[model samples]
Target: MISLLFGAGASFGAELHKPVPPLGNYLFDKLVELGGAFAELPDDIKQEFRLHGFEKGMLSIPNDSRVINPLQKEIAKYLSSFKPSNENAYVRLFRSLREYAKHVNVITLNYDLLIEHAMLMSGAQKVSYGIDANEKSYSVLKVHGSANFVPVLAPNIIFEGNVSIGCGAFIETNQIRSLNSHEEIIKWCDSRQNSDLSPIMCMYNKEKRVVINPKYLESKRKDYTGVISNTRTLIIVGVKYIEHDNHIWDVILDSAPELIIVDPYPSEEFLLLLKQRNITHTLIRDSFYKSVLKLSLHIRSRVKIDPQI
Candidate 1:
């Protein structure tokens, strides 16, 4: 099976119209510019952050409890605020994938719903999360979580501490976040008073998207782990390797499939790491949309050469 793993960079073209950079960088840059306790963070953290550059500053903020909630909101808003363009080649790009690679799946590290919106806009029969399926269409396994996802309450389950929504609850994908058919989710969430009803957004492996879960829940991981392990070709877009995402890194190393990385500014350190691990990868030094278009052209040519394919 083919898997598409996207990072914040995947949404750069869409978010640029918002007049800011990708969601993660915008938040991190804002926080950094604020110049308070955030600026006073350890030198070790700051030093490591310098290696990844601005776009990756989001990774530095995830573990720090003070910024997780704000980070989540910024990510969600940046994602939901932007509507996918009919003219966007990515919509066509993904549509082609669904048509060509019937068994394709998407694993996004981003909290944004851009992929979901694009798929829905392209008239997909179903855009499922994790194990849930319509069987007729594609699935997206959000390793972090989604902005529209909601918590599933369990009455019999008992938990005493750190329940962001309510005790004994787990997150489930909400089919819709917009109140109107044409309204965007960011607008919908902004107008709503009860933001808690929305799924919590965070970076860790947990049920809540809003905070770091110490529980390390297995059910939370089962679907993504299963999907990733079987990935024959993994297309990674705009991700800078970071320590917080070690689990994701583990999967990538273990899968070690045909790798395609999309980033205009690729990391040399990351390239060295990949080389050390002996993982073969094709580095596409272009923006997400353009790189996808290039790959799409190659696939189209192959399809033409073999009519049976």
Candidate 2:
């Protein structure tokens, strides 16, 4: 068994005409709309926004906690409303990948619906969440709470309620408002002190804050453990390996499977880091879609299965 992991960059091929709005822009626009002022901004605010892909002068106010909180909520709402255009390149890529990995598992950090859509398009008979012990077909694990999964709230506890086409499992309306609440949002600014159960909200500037359900985190870890221990090869695509996602890297390194990395241009630093971790079986490719297709064909040709009577 082999598993595949995908990141936001993989969604880029989905052919969204408007680049998914970077976190910084989403935060900035909302802050200005809410009357958040520059003078009230935190000293490190400008630098933070820049990391998420915001230029300093791009927005009117200084990007700081005071301004960013509400902006994040607005951004979440905006993201909730985003519908993929009909002609999506990512859709085709996802379909191709799904067909290629007929017997494998896929884990993605992306919150978008492209992968799900692709699976549906491919006429896949089954898709499992990695939670079931007996599932045997293709599966997808959205590590980060997806945009199409809604959470059910019960006092201090939250659980996955339903999976809708456009809703996410981790981000509740109340959660978004809580994150936007200037007073409550401060609790998450220090990543170390934050609860791991909370869904992690990331700004384009690379700053990450946890805002997930603890239960979900446990489920994710358990599922990951099962997949990693069983899978023989791991393919990583479109992930930028940001510092916030160090935990994922740790898991991959610990798994020590045959590793393959696919990206248009992989950085030397990333390669060095992988090397330092002693992940020797790495393959870099120019096109993730193409690589996955080729790999699948090769695997299918090599494996032989008996037809049951």
Find the candidate with the highest TM-score and give its number: 1
Question: Candidate 2: lDDT of 112?
Answer: 53
Candidate 2 has what TM-score? 0.61
Winning model by lDDT: 1
Error of 1 at 99 (Å): 1.5
What's the number of clashes in each of the models?
A: 5, 20
For residues 1-309, what per-residue lDDT tens digits would candidate 1 score against the true structure? 666777777777433243323444345445456464346656765654556654444445534333444444444554455556765545766666555545556777776666776777666776776644343665677766666653333544322222343323333332322222223445434443333333345542222333423232234456667777887667777776774556677877777776778778888877887888888788888876667677665455533233232
Residue ranges of candidate 1 with Cα displaced over 4 Å: 14-23, 28-75, 131-136, 152-198, 203-220, 297-309
| Per-residue lDDT of candidate 2, residues 1-309 (tens digit) | 767787765665444364452333454554445453433455466455545445343243333333443444433444443334445544454454443455567788765555655555555555555533122244578665554343334455532232222222334333321232222333433233222222234433333332334355446656777787776787777777664555567677677777777777776777887788787666656554446555554445433543121
For candidate 1, which ten residues in a row score worst on lDDT? 173-182
* Candidate 2 positional error at 120, Å: 1.1
Kindly provide the TM-score of model 1 when superposed on the true structure, using C-alpha atoms: 0.67
What is the alpha-carbon RMSD of candidate 1 to the true structure? Answer: 6.6
Candidate 2: segments with Cα more than 4 A from true spot: 16-47, 51-73, 77-90, 93-102, 125-128, 131-138, 154-208, 276-278, 289-292, 298-309
